[model samples]
Target chain A: AQSVTQPDIHITVSEGASLELRCNYSYGATPYLFWYVQSPGQGLQLLLKYFSGDTLVQGIKGFEAEFKRSQSSFNLRKPSVHWSDAAEYFCAVGARLEGSQGNLIFGKGTKLSVKP
Target chain B: SQTIHQWPATLVQPVGSPLSLECTVEGTSNPNLYWYRQAAGRGLQLLFYSVGIGQISSEVPQNLSASRPQDRQFILSSKKLLLSDSGFYLCAWSSRVHEQYFGPGTRLTVT
Candidate 1:
């Protein structure tokens, strides 16, 4: 079965420090990958997505992700962390339903804490 | 751009009470809709999805059901609420592409 894994349950980073959140996925076909961030009591916001083409995709809020097919990974990275960047991040793999629009299978999520 | 909306930001109900959560999408046409629930400290679980009006597919067998009476309107319902049903419910919409736009979400608490 296709699934997504966010290995880190929580990560803490200092302000202005580089950040990386790991994600791995298992799927039979070329996968559609995505990253989303959620603040407390708020809806999730899309960060980035990878369907085809370039392995490196840049998203909103100074976030970027690299899709490594060989490793079955799509890891999110940020050059510098901000206090406001603290939130829960989720990784999802899209799977088609009856050849129609696909559904997202999400990982358990990784919580990022930024310390000033 | 398209936007999704979910009503009753927070709800509190007694056990065995029925549930009705509404979701709607604006500035889009013929979009696909989905219903998801997130339990405390858990990942999002897909409950149901609809590709078109009156076409619903359930991903999990639970006490909840969903309906898409119109192109952009989706509803999640339950005849009897369970204590386990307390969670955050989110509604989302997407086009042919896989990227989905989520609504503000509704927090349901079944006491």
Candidate 2:
């Protein structure tokens, strides 16, 4: 079965420090990977996605993710952490449903804490 | 541009009360709609999806049910709410492409 795993349940980072959230996926074929961020009591916002032709994809809020096919990983990274960046991040992989429709399989998520 | 909207930003009801959550999309046509629930301290779980009007596919067997009466409208319903149903409900829409856009989400609290 196709699945996504976010190894870190919680991570703490100091302000202005670099941050990386690890994600690994298990799928049978070429996979579609995505990163999403969610604030408390709010909906998820798409961070970035890797479809094709690009190993590295840049997303909103100065976030970027690199899709490593060999490792079956798509990790999200930010150059410098901001206090407002403290939130939960989720990793998901697209899977085919009926016909051409598709759905996402999400990981448990990693909670990030930014320290001042 | 496409946008999804989920109503009743927050809901609170008794365990036996009937439940209804509505979602609608704008600026898109014949799009695929999905319903997902995010439990406390957990990731999003796919509940149901609709490829078109009156065509609903359930990903999990639970107390919840979904219907797509129109192309851009989807509804999640339950005959009776469960305490375990207390969580954030999200609605999303996607095109032929795999990427999906989410709504503001509705927080459901079943007491």
The candidate that wins on TM-score is: 1
Clashing pairs in 2: none
Candidate 2 lDDT by residue in tens digits, A1-113: 87899999999999999999999999987678899999888888999988888799999999999999899999999999999999999999986444667788899999999
Candidate 2 local accuracy as lDDT? 0.92
Over B1-111, each residue of candidate 1 has an lDDT whose tens digit, in order, gives 778899999999999999999999999999989999998678999999999999999999999999999899999999999999999999999988989889999999999
* Candidate 1 chain A, poorest ten consecutive residues by summed lDDT: A95-104
Write candidate 1's Cα lDDT for A1-116 as tens digits: 98899999999999999999999999987688999999988899999999889999999999999999899999999999999999999999997455756789999999999999
Whole-structure CA lDDT of model 1 = 0.94
In model 2, where do residues sit more than 4 Å from their true spots?
A96-98
For model 2, residues B1-111, the per-residue Cα lDDT tens digits are 888889999999999899999999999999999999999777898999999999999989999999999999999999999899999999999898888899999999988
- Deviation in angstroms for A73 in model 1? 0.3
